[model samples]
Target: MSVSLMDFHADWCGPCKTQDPILDELKNDWGDRFDLEKVNVDEEQDVANEYQVRSLPTLIVENDDGVVERFVGVTQREDIEDALERAGA
Candidate 1:
């Protein structure tokens, strides 16, 4: 099962900044277990729109089956890990 984590954020968003380190740590620890992509909403409005992102820090967990989980605002590391696990990562 393929899993992808999309982090939708903006450079100027404070909450988004807070979420960055957690994601980086996860990326490092998870290694090749899952794919991670950080999408800056300010620069990638189209991508944000496609995902229907309405919050500064939106996390989308997707698997081969499609989107499995979506989170808005500052999400915790545990919560993300749980979502990723559920997505078969």
Candidate 2:
């Protein structure tokens, strides 16, 4: 199975704000191949701290067993697609 994409973000963060549309587009394109879960770091401080999320727009790719990779910032489509492939999407 493909790894789920966990998106850590905060509404107050500029880059995170910019990532919303991109994520929406990706969800539509990738379909069931990738699962995207958006988490608001500010609203969910415990999750942020637990996940060790130190930056905005953090993308954590976790497979059925565990995490495969972690990406920080607004990720590009190509990069994300590559990551998905690596995660065995």
Candidate 3:
């Protein structure tokens, strides 16, 4: 199962900044277990719209089967890890 984490955020979002470090840490720890892609809402509005993102700091965990989990606002590391686990990463 291939898993990917899409972080939808903008440069002006404070919560999105707060979310960044957590994602970076996860990337360091998890390594290649999952793919992490940061989508700037301002630059990648189409992708954000495709995901139906209504807010900043939206995290979508998807496997080959598609989206497995969606998180809005600031999220904890453990929660993300759980989602990755569920996605079979």
Best model per lDDT: 3
Model 1: weakest 10-residue lDDT segment is 9-18
- Residue pairs in steric clash, candidate 2? none
RMSD of each: 0.7, 1.3, 0.5
Better of 2 and 3 by lDDT: 3
Candidates 1 and 3 compared: the better one by TM-score is 3
Name model 1 segments beyond 4 Å from true: none
Residues 6-65, candidate 1: write the lDDT tens digits.
Answer: 999877899988999999999999999999988988888999999999988999999999
- What TM-score does model 3 achieve against the real structure? 0.98
- Model 3 lDDT per residue over 16-39, tens place: 999999999999999999999999
Residue 89, candidate 3: Cα error in Å is 0.8
**Whole-model Cα lDDT of every candidate shown, in order:** 0.93, 0.85, 0.96
Candidate whose TM-score is highest = 3
C-alpha TM-score for every candidate? 0.96, 0.89, 0.98
TM-score of 2: 0.89
